[model samples]
Target: MPGEAPYLAVADVLRARILAGEWGVGERLPSRARLAEEYGVGRNVVQRAVDRLIIDGHLEGRAGSGTYVRSPRERLRLVRSRHRERPAGFPLRPGTRERGRADAWDAHSQVRVSAPAEIAGRLDISPGDLCVTTHYEFLAAGQPVQLSASWEPMALTDGTPIVLPEQGPLAGKGVVERMRSIGVVVETVVEVPRPARATHAQANLLGIGAGDLVLLIERTIYDTRGRPVETADMVIPDRHREVVYEFGVDLP
Candidate 1:
């Protein structure tokens, strides 16, 4: 069943080319019929390959327009981590509170129990330090909309009331709120975002393929004395989320 189809071979070739930079971001791939002739296969076979790439995030299809490669933008600026004010009329009843408790965003589906090497480095904890990971897959109208992960030190959350999903987003919600209640006054929130490809595990969880473009956001919360308290790394599906920040800056 696996790799038996001619189209599968073609898909593999396309994947290699994209990784090899033969088709750089934003470049257009050859038409299906054209690729079919070149690959000595039927047009249907080539169409299948193209469809696979689209699901994998290597290509984008525009209505009435040709499919193009994905071009990710660089980090726009040094962003400060802050709670995004939910837009008025934006759906709130179905927030993380409801979904996570209902077993909709269960650890079995959304969270990873193991910590990889890279994640360990970001957390500044020893490799394999106990980390409780909670992942969320936000869907909009039956379509996969957004993917995110939240991690907290096991020592901090283990057997704590805050471990419960319902306690996550209460009044003055988010990590900041809970920390403040515990006498941890957060003074700074740092955010860093980069363009990244999904890992094999991430791909399986997000229902996307590896090498697909995704946004990697790392947020670090620091205490009043500037000591890091917690870190959260979120892998967002670009197709579903358009990131924007609103803040007031004083001008000289």
Candidate 2:
């Protein structure tokens, strides 16, 4: 294509070869010097192309060894359905069926943390209002597959048994149930999902290369009285999972 970067052009050719099985999985790719010579481009251009492939999950770079074709990855299905089980007293178990059995998750909660402007907006609270923030990492078979950062206004849960999200009697119970425990009834949940690239910090946590594709879901839960009870940002890696949104239709 006209005006395309030289490195990008080189990357296209190399990507084709990889997809065509010119290099088998775990097979070491030709050196950058050799590829540059073969493609009639500078070594820097070849290096950039290889880096692109690495970021795209097609190749892996060893510390001392050269880049090699990566093994195929299995993408799990992550369903976002409106038909979630809402048991009054039972805490929803961690993990989902799509992620495999024995799925587990860990969470770290910080109390009395001030909500940032964006989070406050999502929760319909003041910018500096005290809130409880919890960071969660969901793993399947010991490998991290998803992450979420949740925030709830402290004013609502303060002095209550559910003050700390991951602690107390209602620990591990979802936002809806916990709020119900304190006489707050949750009625609705809204989620907006957007595609994004992984950042260095997010990549480090999910064990993916930075610049890889990911899905960011912004979720806000509202109560029966139209008050925002909780908000969260869920991150799912593109290479590791496929997101499915299911909705039910009502007939008149």
Candidate 3:
């Protein structure tokens, strides 16, 4: 416990130094032995301190280089947009009314063949369930802005008439809309946000570099009776997409 205490103390000291600008971005930390001597702790304690900093994103370690402070820009500050309108009718570019057709959902590439654990759990389905997934990358000025994937339950969609890549644009009709036409009324919409990495397939689908920053927005559509119907995962590039929220308050 005492050894761990020193490590924690050293971690706090270094974290404060990082926040106070004692170590600039990408600047290397002192060597383990040097840090141990500086902090009057053993090398292992110093190493633990450094590990904690790395996990907290205050420090980074390069394979061939030493531990260094993380760049401030690497810290993502998510900005949600304030606009709320129809979901699927917006043009690929701003200020235009071009219709994005279902054809746009065609399989330009296969990102993940198996349903990821998180997605499967959200959809109340099994992993690797037969799902047709499409990766859609929206670009602005030739850079990837947003990456997203729409998934359908194999039982609900497999062999169904809607599985064709040509049916892509229809997926955005909100599962509720699509279901309503089929006499299924979606009663609930649940959306959750978190940080995640792009799998190999997702990287290929979105045309983003591996391990790049992304925002995972998971949405689950449920029927009127509270049965989960459809789930979608939207990956937004840190620099490309904006999130928005609107609040309605009752006047006193």
Candidate 4:
């Protein structure tokens, strides 16, 4: 298109050179002013071009440093199941393989939160109902890989030992075990996955640029009677992990 923005044309030229290996991987490109002089365009045009490449994952900008070609990221797989989730150590006891290397997490829980409208709808409860909320940050191989926020209705667990998801006797056990301890069987889990732009908070924690692509998963667990016991939102940085879903064949 002849009417395309000048910066876009500049970006195309830069991208071609980068892909053609003119600028070696991890090598900084010429200064914006130098690039402008070479391309016979203004420095502002060169900067816009560089910014476009950055957003396209072709280049990276370091604060107080120049832009350089982006190196390939080391991506891992995070496989989830519609079936039961046992403890990571359950391999010897019979269960699916665990995901992530040296998986670890930090979490905090608060009591008596008012469920937001969206969360309430997911939980099939009235808006503003009392609930317990927990925030989680998960790390794999010493790097932050995922984040989640979970809410559980206080009505079900107020006086129980498992009221707090990560406290008391069953601490560190997942939602399934904790609820099972309280005699509430989690019969089903539903996950809705979608793409989103990383927010400032997510970017800071995941070590990525703001507005980067991420996978957002909304999950809800239900009892045998179809009553929701908990709902959570999981955020996964796309550059770090790819989600896989596997199911066993039914022999009906």
Q: Candidate 3: which pairs clash? A: 80-243, 80-244, 81-243, 81-244, 102-169
Q: Estimated TM-score per prediction?
A: 0.54, 0.91, 0.58, 0.86
Best by lDDT: 2
Which pairs of residues collide in candidate 2? none
Angstrom error of the Cα, residue 192, model 2: value is 1.1
Q: Write the per-residue lDDT of candidate 2 for residues 66-85, one digit (tens) a residue.
A: 99999999887787878786
lDDT of 3 by residue, 53-172 (tens): 765557878887789998753322233332335468643234222222123332343423677887778777898776656666655445445666666666665555455333654645
Relative to the true structure, candidate 1 reaches a TM of: 0.54
Global lDDT for candidate 2?
A: 0.89
Off by over 4 Å in 3: 1-3, 74-151, 159-161, 164-183, 192-218, 232-252
lDDT of 1 by residue, 40-75 (tens): 888888888887878666777777777788775322
Number of backbone collisions per candidate: 0, 0, 5, 0
lDDT of each: 0.64, 0.89, 0.64, 0.87
Model 1 lDDT at residue 216 = 88
How far out, in Å, is residue 103 in model 2?
Answer: 2.0
Angstrom error of the Cα, residue 228, model 3: value is 1.6
Instruction: Give the Cα RMSD of candidate 1.
Output: 10.7
Clash list (residue pairs), candidate 1:
none
